[model samples]
Target: LVSEEELARVEARLRSINQFAPVMHCTHSSVSVDQVLNIHGFDLQRALKASPELLNTSAAPTKHDARVSSVSLDQSAPRHLRTVQKGELDLDLLQEWIGELLNNSGEDIFRMKGVLAVAHAGKRFVYHAVHMTFNGCFDEPWDDEARESKLVFIGK
Candidate 1:
């Protein structure tokens, strides 16, 4: 379990990101994908284009890809596990959803972070994105001991 102070620090980091960044999200659900390319505070469109796969959910992703699990704007609420695709994802649809979140002003989103399970570079990968920033991305063997991705979002 994470300590209260640790959680507080993490939250602070998230708030900093929100103050300066704009991200993409899913309309049907609270899940959103951070545009890493545009994270240094760059063009929203360019950021979306750089990793269009992160935005859309209409294109069939490979059998394995970095995917969101679930999102919640309630900190006390447990974030349910969600996968973009049972086997693969539709990138276009996912992207469209993200775009919707960006345009919605009343969205209760405050902060988000998750571990993305991905298959890349001929190996399994794990990606962590906090707020709209890429926290970490690494390739690992499938047998490594790692917990499933978890995320907690604070509502406005």
Candidate 2:
């Protein structure tokens, strides 16, 4: 069960996204939503070709900066797509897929700021990271479109 503090933290984070404050691990990176959509479209196509399970995910334009959008695990995608990749033999072969992403894609990796869905301790987790360092994860899963994981990375 999510404690009141945890819920409040999540709500606060969601509410304050547009404030441009100094969030740990994430910078107030700036970019257009179209850029994010293009990145998602290209990278996810690659991810899908490498592992079909990713077809279960979706990328939608969020109301953040006109240039801010997000990638989410679609409700119809296989449950395995929601699992974090930690190893090769895992149910959906996701570990290999993520490794490929990290190894082959550098140009598309603008800046690493945003929320991530991480699976740990036998439950789904959500995390917000900025600049790839300041990070925090919650033990609950996000099942709604409004609460989906979002990250904004600006290219240098």
lDDT for each of the candidates? 0.45, 0.44
lDDT of 2 by residue, 76-129 (tens): 346676533322123234335444544565344444443444433333333333
> Which candidate tops TM-score?
1
TM-scores, each model vs. reference: 0.28, 0.26
- Stretches of model 1 off by over 4 angstroms after superposition: 1-96, 105-107, 119-143, 146-149
Q: Which ten contiguous residues of candidate 1 have the minimum total lDDT?
A: 82-91
Write out the backbone clash pairs for model 2: 25-130, 25-131, 25-134, 26-130, 32-67, 33-67, 33-68, 56-77, 114-151
- What's the true lDDT of residue 116 in model 1? 34
* Alpha carbon lDDT at 151, candidate 2: 38
